[model samples]
Target: MSTTEEPTQGTTISVTEQAAEEAIALLEGESMDTDIAGLRLYVQQGGCAGLSYGMRFDNEPEEDDTIFEHHGLRVFVDPASMNYIEGSVLDYEGGLQGEGFHVENPNVVSECGCGESFRT
Candidate 1:
């Protein structure tokens, strides 16, 4: 597992060390199993950028993929989706504004006004 900072210009892409650490902390207290391994981040066809982000807790990984570790949290990305989400960050933000997990993707060329969809 390696930890490094990869920066980008738009939407503050690239998952930061702090974000990963926070993810782990939240997961630990969610009443779920702490042995969840890590999160799987991917891009699927749909949404307003012709592309959309997908995330889930997964224990198994496919044969060819990149696994990144930040503050003991592991994040997995499949090769196929990597091209679309190369410089994106996976963040968990909570507050009255709207508490939920969000993706800050720089590759997004246009997004739906609702902010639930994007096109790139």
Candidate 2:
């Protein structure tokens, strides 16, 4: 978020080392410039639990977005989504069964059985 030396813990959201590595690789694979390109994390109204997680790669953060720099990766979160997942952590799980990014949200009170959605 700053032009100066990047802050370690100043980021509002956090991403795990494994998750950051995987996301960064994905970003680079997209051929997007890593300097400005970042992953956007947001929440939307849907799914069995009332809210669903959404993510995508963006060329650059919006004017109102809160940029989080962590583990050599950049994450963008809008104000609305931040309200639902302020203290959430992004993590990646990889194995034979399945592999993907997971949101470890402390604000979540209940989650759908399939784990595709959750209620704060």
Candidate 3:
């Protein structure tokens, strides 16, 4: 990572060290080409709470995507999705609570019971 106090200007999302580590592990474990692969995070219009988060490994960025690098991990977010996830902190939690990437989004006003979606 750059080790800067703040994310670069225009950066809409932030990834924690743990999240970056986990993401890197997952990407590497998949046996994909890491050089051109990145984690894509976005929002969709369907879910119990009206909006759901979608994430996957992308080999290329869309024309309107914004990319951020944290601890050598690349995170891709689309312009529209950026509005709902600005200042969000991405973390990976394991053990009894659960295991996976969790988004701590400040813009969120409500979330579904299952935590799969949120309303901002």
RMSD of 2: 2.7
Error of 2 at 32 (Å): 0.7
**Number of the predicted model whose TM-score against the real structure is largest:** 2
Candidate rank order under lDDT? 2, 3, 1
**Which ranking of candidates, highest TM-score first?**
2, 3, 1
Best by lDDT: 2
Error of 2 at 34 (Å): 1.1
lDDT of 2 by residue, 16-118 (tens): 9999999999999999887889999999999999999999999998887888888888898887998898888999998996999999998999999999999
Candidate 1 lDDT trough over 10 residues, lowest sum? 2-11
Superposition error at 17 for model 2 (Å): 0.9
- What digit string (tens of lDDT, one per residue) describes model 3 on residues 1-120? 322244557556888999999998899998856666789999899888999888999886777677777887888888788888878888899999878998889889999999998899
Superposition TM-score, candidate 3 onto the true structure? 0.86
Model 1 regions more than 4 Å off: 1-13, 25-36
Candidate 2: clashing pairs of residues = none
Native-to-model Cα distance after best TM-score fit, residue 44 in candidate 3, in Å: 0.6
Report the error of model 1 at residue 52, Å. Answer: 1.4
Which residue pairs collide, candidate 1? Answer: 48-118, 48-119, 49-118, 49-119, 49-120
